[model samples]
Target chain A: MLSGKKRGLQSIEFLQAPIISSSASVAGPLESKSSWAEDFDWIMEDYLLGESSWERTETKVLQQVIQIALDKQQLSFEDIEVFLAGDLLDQIISSNYTARELKTPFLGLYGACSTMAEAILIGAMLVEGGFFTRLVAAAGSHHYTAERQFRFPTEQGVQPAPYSQWTATAAGALVLEAQGNGPRVSSITIGRIVDMNQKDANNLGAAMAPAAADTIHRHFLDLNRDSDYYDLVVTGDLGLVGQDLLEELFVQQGVVPKPNISDCGVLLYDGIPEVNAGGSGCGCSACMLCGPLLKKMYRGDLQRLLFVATGALMSPTSTNQGESIPGIAHAVAIEI
Target chain B: MTPDSNEERKKIEEQEYQQLVEQVRPRPNILLNCIWAFIIGGLICTLGQLILDYFRAQGMSMEDAGAMTAVSMIFLGALLTGLGWYDELGKKAGAGSIIPITGFANAIVASAMEYKREGYIFGVGARIFSIAGPTLLFGFVAAVIIGLVKYLTMLW
Candidate 1:
C-alpha cells in the first residue's frame, strides 16, 4: 500500500529502483585492524583525527566519507540534492555539524542505531516518489564519543557486563541516484516500535532481538516470500546474544530464515574478546552495508540482500529512570 | 475481555518474555569474580600495611602512622587515577580495588576527570563527588547514628 506500488502491507516496490552509485566507509585505528580493513576507503591512524574532541572527529569522519562517496562518483556537493544522515551522539550533532560544513540541504535523522537503514529507506522513497534526483545517505558512530555519552567516560575502565557490546568507531556513506551502475534498492519494509518490556541497558542485544524478529517477520509476510529470499540476511548490531535469540524468534514466528543470516555486530568485530559480545552503534550496519555487503554484491557473491538495522530506542535518562527499552528495526532489500 | 483483564494479560506476557530472555542471557561467573575480588583486595591492604610500617619505622606514632598510610594510599590512588591506571586495575581487581582506600580515591578522581571537560565550575567542582557522593553520605549518617547510640548507652 505504501507509495502505491507495493503488493504488501508495509513495503514499496520501487518502480525504478534507485541505484547505489558509490559508497565509502572510514574506520578508526581500532576498527581498521579488523578483517574487513580492505572494505573501508580510509583507515584513520588515530581516533582524534587531528581534532580536539571525539565529537569533532566523528563529524569529520562522516563529512570526509560523504565527500569520498561523491569523489568516487565524480560529483560535487552541489550536484547532490540533499544529505540525509545521523549518528549516536545527542541531538545528532555529528550529522548536524557535518551538514553545516558540507553546505548541502540537509535532513537530519535520529533513529538511534537504525539511522543507516532508515536513511537509505527514506532516500529511496523520496527518489522513487519523484522528490529528489540524487542524494547522500550516511550514518556514523565513534567509539569514544558513544562511550562518553551512552555509558562511561573513555578512561573509566569500569568492568562491563560480559554480554555488553562495544560501540564501533566507523562511518559509511552511499550516493543514491535515480540511475547508476550499482546494486539497486529493490524494496524496503518499514518497521514498527516493538517493545517486549525488557529493561537491561547493558544487554541491549536481548532487548533489540524481538524488534528485529518482528520486522523481519512482517517483511517476509508482506513480500509473500520465504526465508530463502535473500542470499544474505544481515541485521545491524545485534551481537552474539541477540543473534541467537533472533534465530529462536524466527522459529517461534514461523519465519525461519536460512543459516545465511548473520548479524553485523558479531561480524564487525570478528569475535574480538575486547569487544565482549560484539560491536554496536549506527556505524555497525552502515559500515557493513557500504563496506563488505555491497562489495559482495558487486562481486556477484551475493544477489538479494536484506539489511535490517535494529535500534534500542531508549536514552540513558530513560534507562536511569527504569523505563523499558523499546526496539525498532527497518529492513531494506537490495538487489543487483 | 474487560480492559483490566487485557492489561493483566499484557503484563503476564511481558514477564514471560523476560523470563525467556533471562535463560539466554549469559551470566558472569560469581566464583571467579569473588576470587579475583579477594586476592586483589588483599594486595591493596598489604600495600597499606607496608606504608604504615614505613611511616612507623620513621619514628611516627601508631595513630600518626595509620593516618599517614591512609594519606599515602589515597595519594597513590589519586595519582594512578590521574595517569589512568587505576581504572585498568579496577577492571581486573573488581571490588578488590573498589573496597580499598585507593579505590575510594579513584571514585572521586575518575568522576573529576570525566567531568573536567565540561569546565571547572559545573563540571569538575560539582561532579567530582558524583560517584563517591552516595558512599560519603551513607557512611557519615551511619557514623552519626553509631555515635549517638554509644553516647546514649554511656548515659544509661
Candidate 2:
C-alpha cells in the first residue's frame, strides 16, 4: 500500500496523495480565443512576449507562469521543493533557460507534448512518497518555435498538410502540495512507446491516437475500474481525426470509455477557423487543464476525471531519415 | 552488451516498430493536396500575368513591364508576409505557396521579421537569407550552366 505500484502494470496509486494546491496558465493570441480564454491568468496581445524569437517568448511564458502560480499560492519559488518543466524546442531551451532564471531545483523533462502530464505524474509521486512537500509542474510550446524546429521556418511559405494541427502557443504550470483543499492526484498510469509507423510529421494526430488508446486501456485494466467511475475522459490533443480514431479503437477493443471523452486539441480552437485539424503541442492540453478544467473542478463541476496527455516522440532527424513517428501517452486520475 | 548483440537487437526493434506503425496510421490523402496546390498556384500565376499586362498598357516595353511586375509582386509578397497573411495562404496552398516568386519573397521577409529582435545587423541582415540563400545560390549556378551550354553549341 505504501508502494505506489499496482499489479504488473507499473501504475501508481498515490497512497499519500498530494493536492493540486494552485495553478496558473498563460496563452498566446490564438489560444486566448478558445473557450478556456477566460480561465487563463494572462494572455499576451501578441505572440512576441516582448522577446525577439518565439523560443525566447516561450521561455518568458514559462517564467511568468511559474511566478504567477507561486504568487496565487501566496508563496515564492523558495517554497517549492522542485520545479518540473519542459517544452518543444531544441535541447528544450525554453524550459532549461527558464529554470536558470527561476533558480529552483529543476528536473527538465522531454515527453514531447506530454511533458506537462509527465511532470505532474512524477511531481505527484515524489510528493506523495513523502520525498517532498511542494513541487511545481510546468510545460510550454510556441507555434513559431515548434514550427521552425519540426517543420520549416514560419516564413518559408511551406504549406502544411490537411491533417496538420496548429501548434498552440501557451504555457501552463501547477503547484502540487502534500496536503491542500484543491483536487487530489489519485492515481497515474504511465504509457509505453506505441509507434504505429505513422511517417508523416504533419499528421501527428494519427500517430498519437493509438498511444492515447493504449494508455487509456492500460489504465482501466491496472485499476480494475470501469468507465462509469470517471465523469469524463479526455485526451491531450487528438484533434478531429485522432478523436475519431480513438473512439473507433476503443470500441474495437471493447473498452467503452465514458462517452464524454473530448480532446483539448478539438476544444482549444472550437470556433477559430483555419486552424485545420485543431490545436496540438505541449501547451494544448497543459493550458486547458491548468486554466478551464481546473476552474471547473474548483467550482464543484467535476468530481473525477482522467487526463491522458499524449505526445508524438519524433524528431526532425528521425522523420527525415524515413523513421515512423513514435507516440506515448500518460494518464492521471484527478478527484476533488 | 556486446557489439554484435546490440546491433542485432536494434534491427529487430526497428522491424517490429515498423510493423506496429502500419496497424494504426491511416493513408495520406494526396489527391486533396494536389487539388489545393493546383488551384492556388494557378491563381498566383494569373495575378502575375495581370500585373504584367497593366504595366505594359502604361506604355512600358514588354521587358520593362515584366521586370516591374516582378518587383511589385515581390513587394506584395513581402508585405503580405509581414501582415501574417502569407502563412494563412500557405496553410491551404502547400507547394503552391512555395512554387511562386511571391513565396520566395515571403521566405526572406519572414525570416527577417522573426530575427528582428536580435537587432538590425546580426538578426535581420545576417539571417535574412537563411531561407532563400540556397535558392539564389542554385538559381545563379543553373543560369551559368545553361549559358555555357548555349555558347558551346554556337561554337560547335
Candidate 3:
C-alpha cells in the first residue's frame, strides 16, 4: 500500500518510508603476543587506554555516522525527530551515549545481532504511522572493548574454534527521512524466538540458521511474494558455517531461493584477509547495511533487497540451566 | 515406732539424671579446595592452549592467536557459566578462575543470568550490555575526542 510521492501533490499513496543514509568506523586489532594477557593489555592500551570503556567506541561510530549523514544530507541535528539505536553491550550504552550527544528523543532497542534490523523496522513503522518525519536507526560494536567485557583479557591464552564468527569491530548508522523520491522500506517481517537448546556456542551459525530460515520462509508466506522479486536476500552475520547451515535448512523446508542469498558477515570482511570467517555481533549487519550495501545502492548496483538480521537468544544462565538457545530473525524489504 | 522407722528407711531410694548437648558442623577441607583450584584452573588454561594449537595448525598467524584466544575464552566462560559449573569452580578456587581471561566471560554471563528472567526486552537483552555497555560508550567518546584532538593538533 506504500508508494512514492509525486513532486506536486502530497497524496497519501505518495507518502513513503524514509530513506536511510549510513556511516561507520572502527579501530584496528592490536599488534601483540598471542598470550591472552598481552592481547588484553594491547587492546586495552590501543582502544580502551584513554576511554573509560568500550561503550564509547559504539558512541564514536554512531557519531561518525551522524556526522556523515548530516554533511551529506545538509541537515542539522534538530531536524531529526527520533534516534532509535541498539548494541551488543549491556544497558544499550552505545545508544545512550550517542543520544546524549545528539540530544534527540531516543528509543533504545536490544535484539542482539538482529539489532540493526530491529532498529530499521521500528524507524520505518514510526515514519509509516505518521509519528515522525526523520528518524535514525543505528548500531555498533568494538573488538577489544567487547573482548575485555565478554571474554578473557588478551593476557590469557585461549583457543577459538574455526566455526566461531569474529565480532566485527565497527558501527553503522542510517538516517531515515520521509522523502518522496528514494528507496522505500516496502515490508517488514518480525521474527519469533525459536529455542532448540543446541549448546555448541562455537557453531552459532548452525544454532541460528534454523531461525533465519524460519523467518525468511515466513516472510515470503506473509507477503505472498516470490523470492525472485528481490535482487538480493541478506542475513546478518551468520559467517560461513551459518550460511551453509541456512542453505541446507532452506532446502529441507522445500523453499530453495536463488544463490543471491548473502550474509553481512561474509561481505564485511571481503577485503580483510586476516579475519577468519566473517562478521558476527550486533554491529555486523549494521555496518554492512550502512557501509557497503548502502554504497552499492547509491551506485545503482541493484534494486529491491531483503535484509534479515538473526540473533541467538542464549544467556549464560539459560545455558547453565540446560535450556536450549532460542534464535530470532527479523526481515525488512527495501526497494530503490 | 522402730518398725515404722525401719519401714520408712527401707522405702527410700535415690536416682541421678544428666543432660548432654552435641554440636554438628562441616569441617573445612583445604586439600579439596586446593585440588579443585589446581585442577579446574589448569584445565581451563590447557583448553586455551589446545585452542591456540588448533588455530596454529589451521595456519592462522601467531599474531592473530591473541585475539582468537580472547574469543575462545569468552565462549568457554559463557559455556562454563551456562553449565552452572563456573561459579562452583570459582567458589572452590577464587583467584584461579578470577585471574584467567575467562573471568571477564564469567562476568558477562553471570550478569546476563542475573537479568535473564526479565524476558528479552529487559532481561537478557538489556543485561547483555551491562558490563560492555559502559566500556563501549567510553571508547566511542574517546575516539571522537581523540579524533578531534588529532585534527586540532594537526592544524596547530
Candidate 4:
C-alpha cells in the first residue's frame, strides 16, 4: 500500500535509483584538528589557504573539492550536466565565485546549513528522472567568513557563549551520476520551514531541532518504515543540544528513531574547550557525509542511512528585528 | 488536537526545550577567568606604560608620548588580529585581551578584513566601523556634551 512514487506528503521514492559517482571533502586547519582529521582528502595549512580573504579562501576550497571529486570519478566539468552549490556568505559568494571558475552550468542554492542535503536531493532527482547524466553538488562555509557575516568578527576577541556552535571552515563536493558503482540515493524528504518562535541566534541547535525531528518523522512515515529499517540516521550539525532535542521530540511524537542516530556537529569535534557547543555551518555535514560516511558505506559497514542536513534560516536583519528563526532539514536515503 | 491546544503544546515544548538546553550548557569558571583577565590586562597596560616611558625618554612631551603609545598599542593589536593570533591570546586571557584600546583596533581591522571580499567601497569602507561604530558615536556625543558643559561653566 505504501509502495508508490509519492510518500505521504513530503518524501519521493526514487525508482530509477541515482548513484553517487564520487565525492571529495576538503577542510581547513581548525577542522583538521577534529577527531576525523584523517578523513578529509586535503586539509589546508591555514584558514586563508594563501588567499587574500576568507571568502576567497572558501571559494578556493569549493573549487578544489569539486576538482577532486571530478578527478576521482575520472570525469571533467564538460561531462557533468550541472553544478549545484551554496555557502553561508551573502548571496553565496563562495559558491558563485567557484562556479565562475568551474565553467559548468550552475544553480545556486540557499538553505542555510541544509544546503548540502538540498543540493543532493535536487541533484539525485535530476539524475533519477533522466534529466541529467552527471551532476555535481557542492557546499562549503568558512569560520571567519561566516562569523563576520552572521555574528561577530573572529578577531573581535569576544569569548563565544556556551550555546554558540563553532562554524566549520570546510567544503565538500559530490558527483552524482545516473549509473555508477557507488551508493544509490533511494529517497528524499524535503523539509518544511518550521518555526517554534525561537530567536536566539547563538542557540541554533534548539531552533533547528524541531525541524530536523519533523523531517525525520515525516520521512519514516512516508516510506512506511520503522527506525530499525535504516542502518544509521544522521543529522547535520545540530551539536549536542539539538541531538538531545531531536530525541526528545521523537519520543513525544511516539516515533522511535534508530539507535545509531548521530549528529555530525558532535562527531567532528571531541569536546574541546574552544568550540563551545560543537562544529556547525553548511560544511559540517557536507564534509562528514562526503568523507567518513561515504567511506563507511563503500566498505559495506553502513548499507542504508538517512542523511538529514538541518539549517537555521535567519538573517542578521531579521534577527535584529526580533524575528523568530525558521529551521529546515532535508533527508536523503542513501543505500549501497 | 485543536489548533489552540496545539499552540499551547508548542509553547510548553519550547519552554521545556529551553530548560533542557540550559541544563546541559557549560558554565564558565568565573574566578579563574577573572584572574587571567586581571593578570593579562595589567601586563598589557604595563607594556603600554613602558612604551610611553621610552617615548618620553626620547625627548617627546608626556602628552605626545602618551598619544604615541596609544597609537602603537592599537597598531600592535590590529597587526596581531590580522595575523589571526589575537584570538588565540583571547582564548586564554579572555576579556583581558579585549578591555583595552587594542581591542577596539582589533574590532575595526577584523571587520574591514572580513568584509573586504564584498568590495573595498561597500564592504571594507561600510563595515569598517561595524563594531567600533557605537563606541565612536557615544564618544563623540560625550565629547560634545563635555564641551558644552565647560563653556557653560566658564560663562558662569
- lDDT by residue for model 2 over A34-153, one digit each (tens)? 777889999988988678667778999989988998899898878988989988887889889988987889999999888888999999989988899999999988998888778766
Candidate 2: where are CA atoms >4 Å away?
A: A1-4, A156-159, A257-259, B1-47, B50-72, B89-97, B115-156
Which CAPRI level is candidate 1? medium
lDDT of 2 by residue, B3-47 (tens): 999878867755654454455445556888789889998999999
DockQ of model 4 vs. true complex:
0.50
Error of 2 at B43 (Å): 5.9
State the displacement of the C-alpha of residue A169, model 2, in Å, after optimal TM-score superposition. Answer: 1.6
**Candidate 1, residues B26-45: lDDT per residue as tens digits?**
89878888898899899989
Model 3 bad stretches (over 4 Å): A1-15, A21-50, A257-259, A271-273, A320-322, B1-156
Worst 10 residues of 4 chain A by lDDT: A251-260
lDDT of 4 by residue, A1-336 (tens): 754678889999988889888999988787788778777898989888678877778899899999999998788888888999999988998899998988889999999889999999999888887889999999998888888778887676777766789899888989998887899999999999988888889889988999998999999888898877888898998988788888877778888644468988888776565687878999988999998889889889999989999999999999999999999999999999
How high is each candidate's TM-score?
0.95, 0.84, 0.62, 0.89
lDDT (Cα, tens digit) per residue for candidate 4, span B1-156:
799999899898778867766775667788988999999889989999999999999999989999999999999999999999888788778889888888888889988887777899999999898878988999999999999999999999
Query: Can you tell me which runs of candidate 1 are displaced by over 4 Å?
Result: A1-3, A257-259, B154-156
Ranking the candidates on lDDT from highest down gives 1, 4, 2, 3
Model 3: per-residue lDDT, tens digit, A33-93? 1121121101223544355545565577667666665666677778889888887777878
Better of 2 and 4 by lDDT: 4
* iRMSD, all candidates: 1.6, 3.8, 21.3, 2.2
